[model samples]
Target: MNRQESEAHVLREATADDVHLMLSWRNQETNRHVSKTSHEITAEEHARWWSAVRDDPSRRVLMYVREDLPCGVVTFFDLRLESPRSGAWGFYLDAEGLDGRGETLPAWLGVMREAVEYAFDGLHLDRLDGEVLGHNTVVRQMNRRFRFVEGTPRQELSDGREITVIPISLARTDRRQR
Candidate 1:
């Protein structure tokens, strides 16, 4: 599909069947290298983790689907339903399905737009925070496009190597201005 057509993608709550696919995507080399923890996850670990968050009221795990195919996963955690209405979120797209097919940019843009809308409009969140590995310039730029302002940077270990992670946040008002 073309960029415009791909923009019609949807994000739905992830189901039990998605656990394997999501785990595979999360364990991909590129995804691991850019994540906070780079260790490969075993099926048992994934199952345990999935079971913990699957029914957590403070978390939302969603799958991005386009043309009836899964393209990515988006997750929101640490949801504070009280005053601030803030949360932390992260996402990753299927490289083989989207990027390898030369639809990376558009697919990412569409999924991210939907994710942001879901955060603000559906969840009524006042702000959404994200942390990106310093080396992931593409995602940092994408965050800018979505009006995510960069915050403080911190050091963390990924794959046994020290790496920087920069925090970014998007406020409801900021998104409205966009």
Candidate 2:
């Protein structure tokens, strides 16, 4: 993959049309715990969320575009100025992987890389928090690759799934050495 093709795996800032797609992915069984909703959300509720994000400075809802197609999604949101330089983040890729043609489906590591960069550089955050199902060893390992440490174990109310909330941080003094 060249620069553009590779970078096509990520995009920041989601539009209105992207919200519907996001909700479907969130309601998927694989993404239930990692999502904000236990059930599917209506357009009205989604609009409220979109409006709040736009009105809030410490929030960003982004779409993960791969090969110029919307496949998965990632977000650097819930920014707290009281504890500036910190935010909550999450991502989801379709389990299906990709479609025919050059467009890839589901989610990929390239988007995760860009999402982390957005958390550190784009959002200028010192710490970003994420949660993974205890069963999701692959994602847990992936978090470690980004220096995310298992912070605290918490129960996911959505599906009664046990999860470990990890912190993938990048402080001012500590940039990149990995």
Candidate 3:
């Protein structure tokens, strides 16, 4: 299923059973556009990563479910609890027939809103930030809509062409509106 099929999607905690399925989706070209992957991940690698991921209290990986079908993933890392309450995040959708431009963008916005709220409220983090590819207009638009201020132009993760690193931050004042 794709974005069209994810209208009634549910965001749930990821599990050991969903590793391979998540890998298949993450490998899609649309997803790989901004993802860091040179090759497919091995099952063994996934297991090891999942083990470490599950054991890390500062991280969270959630699965987006559509009509009981798993369709996407979103993960947050590098959580710090002291003066800065924030974490970094990344994700991609796997619903096969859905349009990234039409359906996935909106879905991602809602998920991102919730994720930010969780970071500030539940985790008591003061900020949340992330980097998006300069070529990925759809994602950039979403981040802008979510009040993620654009940062300086940087070649931080560019595959070849210079990619601007866009950062989104959420502060306590920002959360008060929600």
Query: Which numbered prediction scores highest in lDDT against the true structure?
Result: 1
What's each prediction's TM-score?
0.92, 0.75, 0.78
Question: Model 1, stretches more than 4 Å misplaced?
Answer: 1-7, 176-178
* Model 2 segments more than 4 A misplaced: 33-36, 81-84, 97-106, 159-178
Candidate with the larger TM-score of 1 and 3: 1
| Candidate 2 weakest lDDT stretch, 10 residues | 97-106
What tens digits encode model 3's per-residue C-alpha lDDT throughout 65-92? 6556566787889988778667887778
lDDT of 1 by residue, 1-178 (tens): 4566745688999999999999999888878877898899999999998999999999999999886789899999999988789999999888766767898887788788889989998899999998998899989988998899999899986668999999999999998432
Cα displacement (Å) at residue 62, model 2: 0.9
Q: Which scores better on lDDT, 1 or 3?
A: 1
For candidate 1, what's the RMSD? 2.5
Model 2, span 1-178: residue lDDT tens: 5676667677768887787787776666666644535456677876787778766786777887766777777866678656566888777765443433433323556677778777777777777776666656777777776667676555554435344444445453454431
lDDT of each: 0.88, 0.66, 0.69
**Better candidate number, 2 or 3, judged by TM-score:** 3
Our tally of clashes for model 1 stands at 0
Prediction 1 global C-alpha lDDT:
0.88
